[model samples]
Target: MTKRTLYLFGSAAPPVFDIARVIEEAQARGWDVCLGLTPAAAEWLADGLDGLAALTGHPVRSRYKRPGEPDVWPTADAILVAPATFNTVNAWALGLTDRFVVGVVAEGIGKNIPIAAMPCVNAAYVRHRAFERSVQELREMGVTVLYGEGGFVPNQPGRREPYPWDRALDAVDGLAPAAE
Candidate 1:
């Protein structure tokens, strides 16, 4: 069987979350993982960019490619936005494609690609009215949002809770076949 391609999009959250573990888990589950980062996330992980690229055998992308530039990565069968922040979620819901990560997500939705977003915002941010609406909008668009009690519950301010990376992976695994 051909391996499924998974695009993993990460945002700047707690610096302690180990993204390598997510990659390893995906690989073990028979997925070919590609890493995409929000600008802040890329900067936070700048020191390990090369190693991550080497691990995935693809360039870690944070910016839009120049005109006529050949796309370097394979088309994704699934997309996971782990550690998604409040800003990213709201922007994505509002159809803002200003950044590479959000652009891919917006396009992925248009293409009917399966997407799982695991948000890591704090309780304070979760209380924002936009957050609820954004999650609902994304769900209406067929994106699987891993939130609420069983998924990613908002943590207390200035406190970090364990992120449920496995649940995000499972959501992708359980997605309906890509729309033809």
Candidate 2:
């Protein structure tokens, strides 16, 4: 069995080709991909998700704790939170799992599942004291917070070179052997 991977994304960011490319490449290499997005993210851009689901043959999810859903509660080998918004990051860092996105994240963290967050917040919020504290809390909790380039600034739409999808998969592969 291939490793299970969840591609989680936040709301309100332009779509990047790197993400879709990563999913395709990973799947080609025999990884079972799962997708999760914030509610706002669905509103912002969920256009090609059905295509993605067809490619992976797994149900794409936006909610966290729904009972009786056929694909509910699947264990993931890794969780990659891409374009992680400041709101979602802070909420997850501070144990604020009010919504499905955060709730799934909290559950992943609790289970010691490897999580990689590609935060794409504006400069101002990243530099705020509260934001730093929340990030620190996440780091302290063993969550791998991929720091954006230039540290933190207010209003800068982060540099997108190192998306870390492959890196996260490598780490997960190391942590748990892929199912045969």
Candidate 3:
């Protein structure tokens, strides 16, 4: 059986530290995983980036390939952007592609790719008006945003907990079910 490619993008949230394990779990679930990160995330994970590439057998991309450069990763069959920050979510909804992960997911929307996102923001950020509107906009654009009841619920600022990477992957599997 051919493995479906999953573009697992992330932002610079605390949960992003556990991305290696998340990639392993996704692979176990029959996904050919490809890792993408926001610039800050890439820097945060810099020391481990090479190992992550080896784990996924693909480069951990944080920026667009320059003009005339060949694409390294396979075309994604599905996408999951976990630990999506307030900035990433709003930028993506507003079509601001300055960030690589946001850019790919924004374009993925136009390509009709099955995409799911789980935001890892704090309650303080959630209180801002634009956050809800951005979430609504992404949902309206056909991205399955995993938040609230069944997904990520923001904690108080300065508090960190283990992120729900499993829940996000489950949503992705729902979006693109097995042929079996």
Candidate 4:
């Protein structure tokens, strides 16, 4: 059977969130993982881009290619936006596509590709009216917004919580069968 492609999008969050683990686990489950990062996340992970590319056997993408540039990555069977930041969620809800990650996800919704988003925002940020509305909007668009007590619980500002990467993977796993 051909391997399914999973495009994993990330935003700047706690440095402790191990993306390598997420990639490894997805590979173990038979996914060809592709990494996409918001610009800040790309900068934060700049030192490890080479290793990440080697791990996924695909280039780690941050910025959008210029017009006429060839698309390098495989078409995605599903998309997972883990460690999705407050800014990304709001931008996605408002249909902002200045960044590559958000652009792909917004288009993914239109393409009917299964999507799972695990947000990593702080409690204060979650209290913003826009944040809740964004989550609701994404859910209405059929993007699984993994939030609340069982998913990515908002932590106090200035504190880091263990991101539930496994739950994000589970969300994708559940979608994979249907995608096929």
Candidate 5:
């Protein structure tokens, strides 16, 4: 059987700095990982882009190719949007595709692809009405959102708590598990 592919879409969040380790974890779980990033996230990772591409053996795309261009990455069996920021969450819920990362994830819903999101927001952002609504909207659309107590609990603003990457990966594995 073919190896399951995982498309890891990232936004501009601090945890995105640890993407290399996350990719390694996914690969260790028998996933053929592909990396995609929001424009800001791409800029934040600019220095290590080539190394990341080499690690995944695929181009790290931050924007859509022009018309008639071929796709550089394989179709994903499942998509995980980790370290999802408040902006990303709200935009995705509102069906905004202004960014590449948001575009794929929004379309993933219609494609019936198994999708999961682990948001890396702070306690302050959580207070915004949109955050909860966005989470609810995503859940209503069948997304396995890893948030709240068992998932990515929001930390206080100005504080950088460690993100639970393992929980994010576990959600993805549940969505589309690897070979036995």
Candidate 6:
């Protein structure tokens, strides 16, 4: 089975529930799945990690270090940054991995792991020069940023629709040759 590590960033609201579903689908197709949550996001999605773990049958991680638990750090074939919030996106684009989610993404880049970033934010923020610059920087550094229409939610005012799952899966498939 292809190992898939889903890095879930919840720096904002709306929870990336759709992205969660995509990861779940990937898991069903035999990809080993794991999740990383941001501190702010942990508050937003109460029990969400448990639900994701239940669906994926893998532990959801939110910390950068667990001194005695290295086994929890499963290797990954690809990394998906669903609902990439402004804070997380900007931080990552600038090489700031102080948080768990961003840190995993940094590791992926270091190891040449394929990465897909799905940006979720308001039109105003999306139009911001700084934000646009950050996205460009990410692309320039070889991160594939999935483009899609965004919407407003009660908790997540700038939530985008789910990214194209088929394409994401295709990316994962392209990562390796078939096992004979």
Candidate 4 lDDT = 0.91
lDDT per residue for candidate 2 within 49-156, as digits (tens), equals 787667767655677655765554356777767667778888888788777778877888888887766566666666768777877788788777766443222345
Off by over 4 Å in 4: 15-17, 178-180
In model 3, state the lDDT of residue 63. Answer: 97
TM-score of each: 0.95, 0.77, 0.98, 0.96, 0.98, 0.78
Colliding pairs, model 6: none
Task: Give the clashing pairs for model 1.
Answer: none
- Root mean square deviation (Cα) for candidate 5: 0.9
Q: How high is the lDDT of residue 166 in model 4? A: 87
In the range 42-152, model 4's lDDT, one tens digit per residue, is: 889989999999999999999999999899998999999988999999999999999999999999999999999999999999889999999999999999999996689
Worst 10 residues of 6 by lDDT: 149-158
Q: Which has the greatest lDDT?
A: 5
| 1 or 6, greater by TM-score | 1
Against the reference, the lDDT scores of all candidates come to 0.89, 0.64, 0.94, 0.91, 0.95, 0.66
Model 2 segments more than 4 A misplaced:
1-4, 7-11, 15-18, 68-73, 148-180
Overall local distance difference test of candidate 1: 0.89
- Residue pairs in clash, model 4: none
lDDT tens string, model 3, 24-63? 9999999999999999999999999999999999999999
The root-mean-square deviation over C-alpha atoms between each candidate and the true structure, in angstroms, is 2.3, 3.5, 0.8, 1.6, 0.9, 4.1
Candidate ranking (TM-score, best to worst): 3, 5, 4, 1, 6, 2
Question: Candidate 6: what lDDT?
Answer: 0.66
Candidate 2 clashing pairs, residues 3+ apart or interchain: 1-179, 1-180, 123-153, 123-154, 123-155, 123-156, 124-154, 124-155
Runs in model 1 lying further than 4 Å from the true structure: 176-180
